[model samples]
Target: MTGPRLSTRLRFGAAALLVAVGAAASVAAAPDLPARMVTTWDAAGEPTGTLSKTAGMWLVPGLAAGLLGLFALLPRIDPLRENVAAFRVHYDRFVVVLTAFLVALHLSVLAVNLGYAVDVTTLAVAGGAALFYYLGTLLPHVEPNWFVGIRTPWTLSDDAVWDRTHALGGRLFKLSALIAVVGLFVGEYAVYFLVGPALATAAVTAAYSYVLYARRGDDGSDPDAAGRTAK
Candidate 1:
């Protein structure tokens, strides 16, 4: 909604480019990296563990590629493919966000291995915050689909429940993202800002969906409730 609507091909291409750039960067930096790359870090940005250089270099790119493939396939195969189509723009935006986040992490790791003094934990927290903010933006616009949005038995069974829950979820998610931003200034407690509120938002949204479903007084067995038409 903020800019020109992008074609699925373009959005996916953007995500692919991010993965490719990270892969290329890894390759370019290969000779300079140590035998083992420090891959894990504590909240204070202290290195916690390492991965064999090759494995560390490729792992995130591989995961990003795999996720890109999965995101492409899921929309096509979902039972409510039409619903996914209705919100394809936002969904694609989310895919790009997720891809960018992973690639950023990959490049950040690459930078660290190249002896750059990068604070990876801060980068992760910032990336996670951005991801959640995008998710908040996407949720309210999402249509009922098997693969995305806040899926629960209640939300799946009724479009009203799905809409209501997602609306609430959108706000909670945005709030959590803001809370995560606040953590950036708090020192070692930074990660807790991202984790705590995100987890709470998820739990709250699922429960809200359940309670709303029950309050509607349906046992949720009716096929028509799922927006399906019998052939």
Candidate 2:
């Protein structure tokens, strides 16, 4: 692929437009909720309350867009350009979906503030949205760039490590999507619905690294062996 023919100026301008549009939409869509401390019961029969009210919903998209616009204007300076071509589609999808999830999450917070009882359907949709967005981060082209993907020390050290971790991450994210989808039917266990998948994903990724390391030998002498083992 020759890559898109977009010049730096055009790309920057387009990105700015997107940011403006997204910011406007997010502000318009978000409703003002009360400042009261909202409480919700978790799966363990404990009530949890913290400040869910956020101005970030209105601000983060624009901030992200601004950063992206800056990157477009000077992609040569953008660190993510290294492996971007490899994961272009995945990266693009990830950004779009992630933005959507953020928007949805902010909207849901607004709904809760307006006294809309967070029900099973709402929980499921929210979870699903988040999971899908996260899944995009697992694409091989995505890698351990600054803003996306799993950015652990191990993953950042070697391209092989990053690739393996992301592959594992993709599967975990897909599983999380399934778990979240099923959670929709289980009702108020939504906290568990969310927590379970996250924990599972973390556990799997950690285990994957450990297993890969062990198979690679203590001296770190066998790159081929390590890759094969991870695979």
Identify the leading candidate in terms of TM-score: 1
- Please tell me which predicted candidate would have the highest lDDT against the true structure: 1
Candidate 2 local lDDT, 65-161, one digit each (tens): 6656544443245587666655555555454554455445444544555666655235535656465546735454574566556766666655566
Candidate 1 lDDT trough over 10 residues, lowest sum: 222-231
**Which residue pairs in model 1 clash with each other?**
none
Q: 63, model 2: CA deviation in Å?
A: 6.8
Model 2 per-residue lDDT at 35 = 44
The residue pairs found clashing in candidate 2 are: 87-141
TM-score of model 2 vs. true structure: 0.63
Cα lDDT tens digits for candidate 1, 1-231 = 434245888999999999999999999999999999999987777889999999999999999999999998998799889888888999998999999999999999999999999989988999999999999999999999988999999999888889989999999999999999999989785988999999999999999998878777445444334554543
TM of each candidate vs. truth? 0.91, 0.63
- Total backbone clashes of model 1? 0
In order, the Cα lDDT scores of the candidates are 0.91, 0.57
Over 4 Å off, model 2: 1-80, 111-130, 133-137, 143-147, 217-231
